[model samples]
Target: MPRAAIEANERMNLRVAAQQKATLMRAAALVHADLTEFVTRAALREAEAVIKSAERIEVSERDFLRILELLDNPPPPNEKLRAAIAALPRDR
Candidate 1:
């Protein structure tokens, strides 16, 4: 089944050097895509990559093992944690 086309109602404007604009137009023509479509597709691809990289956390194998070990052999809560927990309101 064919999908319905989405309407483009928003606008974004930017200024670039004439050479840069020409280069983008040339690349778009080589790919048989309209200038707006090509630029937006490339921008969106890069944006998604940037967002994924920012949201990802990388841990070393040694640190990961340490985390698992800590979880398995957790320490007893000390005075501060006990006081904080006790300070919470109790139900009637």
Candidate 2:
């Protein structure tokens, strides 16, 4: 199945000093890239790290079956889980 395009809900607006901007331009010049290309490449590298850290782990076939078995017969809720749930902030 194909997935539909999804728009992001958040945006960031960064501010920097003139000196910093000059330094960035110089670095971009050294790399023969425009400011937009340099900024995008740097942002994309950080974004890749963020995405890798946030993703769920893939399991082996045997481990996946074990996970399914656990889901079929889930353990009773522990006190720690109950406390954690209570401590969590309510979503709007």
Candidate 3:
């Protein structure tokens, strides 16, 4: 979505060292971007990366094969499992 189309009613404040602020300003100028735009993009990129890392599951190759094997040849349901299945609504 274009920036103009989005409502900007929220505010975020940050504090940084003088040198860090100067560096950010210089980098923004070098890229011909507004400081807010550059910082927002960088922060958003990092946020997405952090979210992806947190949500993703990373299993070893051996564990992955074991998971697939269990799926393909699951054990027979025991008494508790059978009861749970029987409790489900049949009209679905």
Off by over 4 Å in 3: 1-8, 75-92
TM-score of each: 0.63, 0.48, 0.65
Best by TM-score: 3
Candidate 2 has an lDDT of 0.85
- lDDT for each residue of candidate 1 in 1-92, tens digit (9 for 90 to 100): 23446659777788999999999999999999999999999999997897778788779999999989999998899999999999999995
**Candidate 2: which stretches are off by over 4 Å?**
1-13, 56-92
How many Å off is the CA of 55 in candidate 2? Answer: 1.2
True-vs-predicted CA distance for residue 73, candidate 1, Å: 4.3
As a whole number from 0 to 100, the lDDT of residue 38 in candidate 3 is 94
RMSD of each: 7.5, 8.9, 5.9
Clashes of each: 0, 0, 0
Could you give candidate 2's per-residue lDDT for residues 1-92 as a string of tens digits?
Answer: 23446658644456889998899899999999998789889989997787777676878999999999999999888999999989999984
The TM-score that candidate 3 achieves is 0.65
